[model samples]
Target: MPPLNSTNNTESENVYNCPPIKHVPFPRSTSYYLQSEITDEFLQFAFSFLAASFQFLHLYRTVWWLPDTHMHQTVNFHLIDKSVALFLLILLSRRFWYSICITCVDLMVTKKRLYRMRLVLRYVFFFVITILLGICCVDIYFKHNNRVVYMCYPIIVYVIIFHFNIEPFLRTVYEGDMIYINGSPLHCCSTNPSAIRTEIDSLKKDFNNRFKQVIFTTLFNAYYGSVIPCFFVQNFVFYDIWITTFHMAFVLVGGFTTSTMFCLPANYCDVMHRAALHLGGWTRIDHRVASPATPWSKTTVWPNGSVVKYSGDFYRSHGLTTTAIPSNSYDNKFYMFFQNPAHIYTILSLIQVVIIVTQLFVLYFATEWHQMLSLGFLVLCNYFTLFKMIRDFFLTQRIYESESNIYARNLSN
Candidate 1:
């Protein structure tokens, strides 16, 4: 047939490489923030690689309800798979923990004039602490197979929530670029700052206006939405995460970790909203006094008052950066609260502790819903923890690595 011959000719030409047209995919318009640099994507990839490897050396000896029954329907005793999984668990968990400490240190240290030796020492301090944690977990005093149910059962539940339920919900819901909650992938799309800011802001607005519309979307179809029926009712997975991670079946691990993770988003929302209110002038006037400023930060000199904070440079450039763009002073001001990051962080963290305490009772009494709830909770907790880890990394870059062109130009002189 003519069609078959034509197709064959095209294939032959492509195979022979007679200058066939390349089928390179065009980048999306929204990906404007992703410049020619491969650096950011590589760093994110490193973050994800570490996350996936978190399971390494994950051994806990605990008392078991049943001496030899499997909680996850099946158990893989294969040495290779076991080893890989364990490594992944540990590495991913470690990255999450490190993200917190690193963020704080970077923010604090970068603000001051510093030497290379101190910066290098700070990095060494981080690794030394991590190694100590690893050593403690390896001892036999902690490893009691008698309580494996107490150990593996809850962990299994957590993994289910992440890999099976909570993560899938986020991926299906957040369009364009998402890498679940715990892991990063090869595509550099997810961390392009401008795209992320736009997408997340849009989602939050959508959430604020019409979260109930969750039912009509394809994520909540007749079949898969049944996997999480609570979405049909509340139209969100956030509640499910809250209800599940507080299980008594996992008082020590689930209770502590779940509450910690849950606070991350709630805490972020509170902090950002507080800063937004100040920038938007919601605290002063009844009407929204509009301004062309980002929600997270803004700086306004009193129209008549002197901004006596800096020297001649502040007055010279008409309040713009040496790059001739608007100065990021507002952004810097918002983060200045990092000396504390606001009271709501403490409040949410404390409330998270209370919820875990309540969960202890729920575990002892609520038997029927235990497995499902615990599993769902575990997923939510890990997802939140993963999210917090990413935020921690990004915030550090914003505060520390962002070029202070003012400082740089002066330094060169």
Candidate 2:
């Protein structure tokens, strides 16, 4: 370890109170500050749960209660249902309020206690939402009517998907590889730079592993992908037009927003990996493509003036190598060994396109209220998916550009 000094003390202090890193820029230029103030995981969880609630709760109401009629006998019943719904809406709104308050706290307070509290609140809410969803499923199934059964069949499946995998889901998203990898605690804010780097490496591994799980479970898994659309379709014939509209709109909007989060981990990993490689001067170069004379070969030059061309023989013999110079020692010994999720993303996009096309056709011929709900949902999902895809493209481009600049500057030096 390096000798302790004023510089080392200051570095330790910085780690103790350092604000969480912000990777993705918000759409609004002004919101960049806001993004730093609030944790993305909390924000995304709040939005996803709120959206799921809109679908789950509204379906619950329609499943359990008959439509409101202004008759003397049923007036009280209608009032009770409406009151309960209003209360749930306020409850959901509180999550957004909590997120804003957490942002404020993050800005003004850097206490370890406060940070722990924030994590607690986050887990508490996640648990609450999971339980609430379970309650909704149980309530619907107990009704024992054909209409109720039909309306909640999709929900039952949704509940099952979440229920079974929720443990791994929670581990992957919130904990990542940060927790319980070993018996000892690995502090993210360590006095030793290598320790910190180790923590970050674990974090990157968590991102890759978590994303792989999400892509498999939610996107490409056996039946979960199809079930997402079914969530929009089940309430069609059972609920009143207005109720169906509210439920459908909320589900569609909520789902679209939440689904974007699934892509976040992969995007973050991509940026971080590239950034590490560029900073380390280990980025693979394609000299073969750069020259007209040798238009089809790839080659990379080392900082020490060693030149090597790409070939099966070369790779087998030499394997991968990193720069001898250690400029940014804070970044853990990173390796660009992981495969990019770009192909997985492409396959997901193709699947989404097919689903959207099929859904659109269903909507075009849909004459009923429920069918219209499904249609509205698919349209919203498509819009959001396209928007997210475009945004990711730009984000990736920006990261690559940043990497290129870093490489160029290092090369010049």
Candidate 3:
């Protein structure tokens, strides 16, 4: 089959007529469109549970069983804690990195001299931070308690704060520009075929670049966050070895889910959907056109084929001139459950709640004030995550339900 970039109308017609890509069949009850997402969500939940359990076990053993002097002599808990915190911040700030890169690209194209200076300064800053973090890890490995290593702690904290604050400004600046993958620039109704093809290709490249960056960074963080911290513990006994092994194992699983099953499929779908919108909706393109871009190991074609459904209001909001694609009548329970952002957030909220409760229970039994403080920090982090999940859940549910009601009313009319 010709690639999606084919410009000739006859060639496009031939592409559309090609048979749908075949795949191994799934159970009839499950919608193929949702299979990967649903599976990924469940795997994410399992990974979260395992990681939280292992973290609690680690905290308990270190605080209650190990002799205080031996613990202090054998490991620098302060260094390990800070290093782990930095890694966690890195993992959580993937979107921030994505936005920054896009902003840099925009600056390069629109303001060349400014972009050059910003790029050089940013690289230098990143290099310095990386070296400092590396020095901290080296100190941890050799069990040295250098005061200078503490510097990275505050720097990482500042970066995380800056990420949260700057991301909104970046989004506002590039709200409807095609320079970023998420940008929703509306096309004229009579857009040229070549321009549409070019835009699709550009978007695909952006998605690929963003996806690779996420995978690389997640793996990097997993190494620092999960593996390096284990080195701080002496691992002298069977219990120590077991704890270290399980903790590392759980983190590896979590990293895999985060990189492949969770982020990959979701990002792939969103980019493809956005591409479909650019082409004036799913009806204009052949399903086969998107098959090549999907993460084939995790996804399959919908048995009855899938559709992109949005209302005219969605188009207007995005400043699109194209007509809205109608909803499919065959949308199944699995499709609804997986596609609804609220449902995903609800699952995350439940997981966060369980983790918080577990941490609090462990904290109650702790004798050491330092251990209590450590547990308190973890509890606070989980609480924050839970709050975001709950807020998103309600907001998404309201929007989606309102859209559904509007669609229903329009159908009845």
Q: Which candidate number would show the highest TM-score if scored against the true structure? A: 2
Model 1 lDDT per residue over 1-413, tens place: 00112222433432342211111232222222222113322332233332222111111111234667553322123322332234333432443444444445545675554435345644665566447534433431244324223222323533543443222221212222433222211122221223323433443443332222222121122111122122122222123344322322232333233323222233233333322221211111112332222222112211111122232122211111111112445433332332233343444445545544554555456544333344345345444544444444344334322323433443345
Q: Estimate the TM-score for candidate 1.
A: 0.24
Q: In the order shown, what is each candidate's alpha-carbon RMSD?
A: 22.7, 11.7, 14.3
After superposing candidate 3, which stretches have Cα over 4 Å from the reference? 1-112, 126-177, 180-219, 232-339, 357-371, 411-413
Clashing residue pair totals per candidate (backbone < 3 A) = 28, 2, 0
Candidate 3 local distance difference test against the native: 0.41
TM-score-based ranking, best first? 2, 3, 1
What TM-score would every model get versus the actual structure?
Answer: 0.24, 0.45, 0.43
lDDT of 1 at 240: 33
Using lDDT as the measure, which candidate wins? 3
Report lDDT (CA) for all predictions. Answer: 0.31, 0.40, 0.41
Error of 2 at 162 (Å): 12
lDDT of 2 at 33: 23
Model 2 ranges with Cα > 4 A deviation: 1-112, 119-200, 212-270, 275-354, 398-413
